[model samples]
Target: MVKKCFFFFSFLFSLTFGQRVIFGDDMSNLPGSWTLGGTPGNYWTQKSNRWFSHSHSVKCTPYDNYNNSVDVWMMRSVNISGYNLGVLTFWVWQKTEGNDFCQCQYSTDGGTNWVTLWQRAGDYSSWQAITLTNLPNNANRIRFRFYSDGSGNDEGVYIDDVILYGVNRTTTRIFLENGNYFPEGWTLGGNYNWTKVTYRYKSSPNSVKCSPINGYGYYNNQDNWIDRYFSLTNYDYGLLQFWIYYDTQNPQDSLLIQYRSGGNWFTFATFSGYANWTNYSYNIPNTADGLRFRFISDGTTTYDGVYLDDITFDGVSTPWIDLTTLSIDSPPGLVEFNDTVSVSATVANFSPYVIGTPVYYRIGNFYNALRIVDPVQPYTTVSVNFPDWIVTQPPGTYLKRCSTAYYRDSIPNNNSLTGTVTVVGNFDVGTIQIISPTGTIDSGQTVNPSAKVKNFGEGTVDFNVKLTIGSYSNTQPVSQLAPNEERVINFDPWTAQSRGNITVKCSTQLTNDINPGNDKMEGSVFVRVLDVGTIAIISPTGTIDSGIIIPKAKVKNFGNTNVDFNAKFTIGSYSDVQPVTQLAPNEERIVNFSPWVGSRGNYTAQCSTELSGDMNSGNDKASGGFSVRVRDCGIVSFVIPYDNMPVGEYNPRVRFTNFGTEIANFTARIRIGDYVGNATINNL
Candidate 1:
């Protein structure tokens, strides 16, 4: 119900004056000018359960729940004096706790100081429509407070359908002629049983039937109604067309369309299941004075119940000039190929008067003409450039419209406005990766190789970048390259005389290159010569708790020259030898052996690298495995019962370990055929 952080004001006077619903309420009952203040018994009530439109709603600690140190208040007192600006809609449903609030105050005298205008505090699970906008034209009292403190309490606020709008400028018209049935001032309350039906009419032999027929009184829990009254004092803007036909019992038997303003009654609209003569319009609140047509029913089901007719009520002034085409702000959604781009468009004058249009601007099949010449008031918004665009169009997506010719314009479906652009590909150079001869390279090594060239289109480019391999090609020369520029190139040093996996490509020789699929790039390198490997055995891995055991290896020198090796460090049956001295070429060393005295067994730890012109002798050996426990624990792998038995009821699992040096306690057992299970193990 309350979770504040609001700010979205947008009310250009609802687009220059013309909205009217002077004051409203739909709480259905309790409305003797509404008063109920401050926590009397936790005031404010009228709840017909919970409603946003018809049944009822206006609760704030209605029956129970909301207590703790409540602070209720519901006030009302609106005259809107002469309306300078006003708009305060409503429909809320809140439940509070935490900072517990609900406030929506106003009041400029009359009820003493107040001024909040919207506050919230917690869960707002659903209905939320609050509109309030720049009010205070001498604030005429409005309220809703519901604060709490002593701790927690919920289900607090739920005010629905309240409204209040002002601002009028006179303009009137009204008609009802259905062969003049009850059309004098029109009135017929609750069970008057509306009649005058010639089978049904939208504008002919007469229509207006809610009952007096067969189907409508079947379930008979009806609450019929029909009203008319309309003075609209000085009018602001209104429109209330009609033409209805129905077959009730849809959403629990319906039909409700109210509007009374200032003295309450709000229900905007609602209908039932089947419709036919359908035509409905609404928006009449220039301080509305009346117009209702209820038709409820709910004891059971019933159909074919309503059928209103051509009732018109327009009083809207007529001065519209909406020409919107809001966006296509210039040359930027990506262009390049021939690139010229300047094109702009952002039109918008959501009508109320002042226009003077001539904005065409297209792009794709090209077309341009912009002449707004000032004068575009109302809600104003301009920015029309259109003229540069040159993008020869080749690589994809294009559209981009933007029209507005304003003549008798009153919203010609929003004039025009399309958008999309993306051309790309003027010269596009490529190859953006492959830096240096990757991975292992040794056979007489010389290596320089580099790559990474970019410049993807739009001018400036002087490329050359090539760097094959295996047949050893070179070429480097990239000179200008601007436009997303990259550039790394470096070739010229090739020597690795052929040995094994080679590939390595790298291209980009621009000269009319129009997207050759990103030029080229491939990679791989591995030449070799005298090698010397071993690579890893550093310290007896995994499990060991016995005694002195120094045995390491890791030798490297995949040679190109400078080499000297010996490595070797067995285990299990014990063996040792180390000597790796001048290891230079690709160099890496760590070979120490000579101290071995172990116990409790589970060993296999080889490590070799003899090297005497090795020449890739299968990477010169390396193995591993260790275990010299002083007290071990077991089970290492077997999750849940495994051999496809599919019978059910099972919880046995396993994956245990404790290759130990002390601290061990255990008990684990599992069997299938005879079904046996046990598990208990700790400290190891």
Candidate 2:
């Protein structure tokens, strides 16, 4: 067995003070050095004393004062940051019959000046740390002032330990938001190159003094400035604000920020006066590469140097950016007529910004794409709708475009993404229409002319039914009609600007111009002298049923000259129509019979006029019921499985559903034209 005996002894001794350090349980003379101020003993009071302590604290004693009175402190120097130094925050323990008060003050220029960074005077039942966290970057001396206002029974206060923080700058540190920033006073503006720099500050009292680098020193010197630099590749905005320490010694100091470009510096702001640190704002479009800032002493003589710290830079936002407004970036791809073209685009969200938010994407014109900016988070891209006539595109290059997006605003500032962009393109010539004239018609009359518009020399025009004039019952204003649809355009000579040829231009947006089909309805109408029957709307204007041919006539004679009426009128949408030129004297002819191409509603027929020998002559004679509306070609709607079946002759496996109330005729040709789908002719 190993002889293991631990030797341990507990000693207890109580003795007097003199050559032997006391060690007693009564804790009277067994003292090591627990100082309240410069004495190691049980001594506490509220007064003005102490400079620095070995415990290295900044706390001092508290004194009594009236409610309106403040404790006056006298200290040494201070410096403006490069970093926060140290402070021995003072504290007081009061028996508060009411609220107690404590204040921390620093006098950088001796007892002559003092600046209060923090103060507290609420309930003081316990001890509190009246902090001096705002120590200048070069604060050399400091002090603490305490007050009671003598409200309650003057129960007084008790103070003890006075600790001095920041005795070592190597290991001292202040806590900050991990990812978040200090918002202001952190980021610099212009170029902070020793000469001119902008440093942000926390806050300050009105009057202060310092040597150089301390917060108090910076506040007092106030000669230099801070700045930053950034490139403006396109168009962007920069907004700024700052906190400044205003003092009486610096009666007239101004704060300034400038933009430097083209060898000239433009000052963006100028803040002046005598007050504590506060905030001010400014905005500018940074279209250049260089920007500078300054915080100078603009007083008559050498005004106290303006202590300038903390300058911030941010961008502005344009919230109205819609994806539809976005254009292709860079030398935009061009196109001509009858060619293939392909181009890409950037779609903007026009919404607020989130930290790591995702962007959405869209392809064709599908409505579903709008829900998300992009299918993939990283790439948000869309394509342009290619028009028919496209031409040649240069090799190995993208088109110039502009982005329409609003920048998400944040704490500092918001911005708009108004940037220049480049996109890949297959450029070609765009299709165009001939902008001349289409047809001719007498004044006060209506005419339907065929404006020739074509993309591929042979492609037929395709238009939706809802886009036609008939669908709106012609109540709509003068506008362009879809392909194959009849347009009843009245020539209002009363409103004509010229006399010769009154050209009623088709809507410029029509697809065809020269051909009068789309995008460009172009043709000239020969403005002729007015006619009596010219005002008469064509009755049964289209092909009439060979079985029901009963025609009515209208007679309006205006001319004093005499003439014979003999002309045949026919009826049909595009079926031939004739005019009856010969007729009896003052007698109105009533037509009662359908034309060979008759249907239901109304149509125009060739009125073969056989004038009687007894007929009177005049420029205006019996004219007619040319206005016609064909009723129903068995208005049929054939529903194929898919609403968008391709064009072909293979029957489409369809069902015939009639919207009209009448039997259709299979003998009647199954017309496959325009946008109407191929229909199965029904046997009546």
Candidate 3:
């Protein structure tokens, strides 16, 4: 995981112990010990396209889409037998389907059974740090597994910079005594010709020689090397000192000193030509775990090779001092613009070294530097004060940062801290919102209008809020509203006189308000009076029979007040009036007119309301047309032979009449018991 920011403290503290990296990998090269399995085709592989720390990282389903129903994993097992507690940290970039998951698991009983540590499913655009803490004492193995369902596939997950830290560990040094034999942990490689020689010695007894024998030229095409490995964990600085004497062919046959870090070796220094036995010291990286001395000879020429002795490697714990910003002590909370106030920060030293450094503080574009004249002792805290600062920027919030300048600081992550400060005007007030009389209102009724006012300044304020709607206006006073406080002000009651949509405004009136942009607010209200109108003609519509037809109309009260009105209905030259009694607000009623003798023709019908104070006249009247057709026909009388005659086929006399003014042709059938007769008549 990557470090983000520093944390500061104002109390004395000591550095007791530090975390040591027990096992880690930068993923530069694939490790031989780590194994990858599950999901035959799609597996986790090492790629160099995206990484967190080094040049490479392990990615699941690299270069192509992952196969469905895959459970691929990359795992490594570590032997944490002696360590009590450990913390595992790593970074990952994942983009998968909603149901697909990326899981981190650990195992204690080898690679047999696993316990889940963390799992997540969804999209993460950037790399995110993940830390697993409180691992069991017997935990040893860790693995990353990606499971995909049989659905949406996307760019898979990438992992990098995996590290495991062990607590309560101490640092150790590596050294070799002057003797006639090689050390226990040391090994010889290549030609294996390196041995201890008595004649050429850097110390008292003897020194290891890379040549065949004394006073003899080395063999041609010779390559011999010796190396030793050490556990250089928990250390931040290291120095390697050794005595060397080289007498090889200049630039052709030489000895190379190299160190190994992260399983890769690099040359630190190269020596050639005749040189006396001299003490040499070189800085070694804290991450280095092994050192080597290799001697190479060309096929042409070679000399008395190289000799080394009295080799020593020591891990040094240097003086480290950390400065932390605790707090900004002056002008707390909020401040007014253009006002001067002293700025200071409480700082602490968390190491065992005396610190004499400068503290720098900044607020937006304004910054200043102050020095800590007296040396801060080990594990002590002090306050550093800068010059007074005047707030000149606009009314808003700014970030305030305080940092310490210490060149010899070991841990630089805790050097600075940041906070926020808000600036406001000295006297400012504004109207927040209108509280009452907003949506709809009734005319000739007294309404109480109210609004919410706020004090947006640094001090208490006294102001007046005024509410206006057309010609009617009222004002209310608010006294001593504290900073960042709000109050709802209600003005005197006003009677509404007009109709339709009217704009209502509320504003704050102060003597010297710094900000007036939010001082006023406007809203709308729909005003309505007593109104009753005909909505529709419910009866005598479409087609009807020609006779005494009755007309009906639907009327509604579209106002705030109730009233009694008369509705008039008319069809051709015939008209009638119906009285509606006590109609409630927003209510509807149906009015029926007297019967009218309508003839056989197409006629237009009209209905209207007669309310004296109808505010909206647009919906007072409604008209419609209907067509009446005369198609009446009936039989006046019928004669049958012998009312109770016997069951036999017989003819009967019948009479028919067409009440309509058109010709009629039809057929008639008569049946009595089992006897039946039929007749067809035309043009009566």
Pick by lDDT: which candidate is best? 3
Clashes of each: 7, 166, 0
Regions more than 4 Å wrong, model 3: 1-228, 239-288, 291-314, 320-337, 345-354, 362-383, 393-425, 432-522, 527-684
Q: How much is the lDDT of residue 78 in candidate 2?
A: 39
**lDDT tens digits by residue: candidate 1, 181-289:** 4434578778646777777777667677877773344346888787877665554456676678888878888888988888889997888888677555556767888
Model 1 bad stretches (over 4 Å): 1-238, 241-312, 315-359, 364-397, 400-428, 441-451, 456-484, 487-518, 521-523, 527-574, 578-684
Best by TM-score: 3
lDDT of each: 0.72, 0.34, 0.74
TM-score of every prediction relative to native:
0.28, 0.22, 0.33
Q: Rank the candidates by lDDT, best first.
A: 3, 1, 2
Runs in model 2 deviating more than 4 A are: 1-242, 245-254, 270-307, 311-684
Q: How do the residues 1-684 of candidate 3 rate in per-residue lDDT, one tens digit apiece?
A: 010010011122233343444566657667545788988877888887777644578888755566678999988887655554455777799888887899888788887877666778889958887776434448778888999999888888888767665533222345653434564457778764677677687766677788657544677777888887876565665557678888899889889999999999999788899988765656587889889988888889777878888776756444445667667776555877678978888888787655455556777654443343246666788988876777765455678878765533566778888888877677788999998788877677678888999988776756788989888788888887888998999888878888767899999987558888889999988786878888999889988878887788899998766688889998888889889988998899988899988788888999999988677789999999998878766767777666677976556877778887556677877776676888886776
Cand. 2 TM to true fold: 0.22
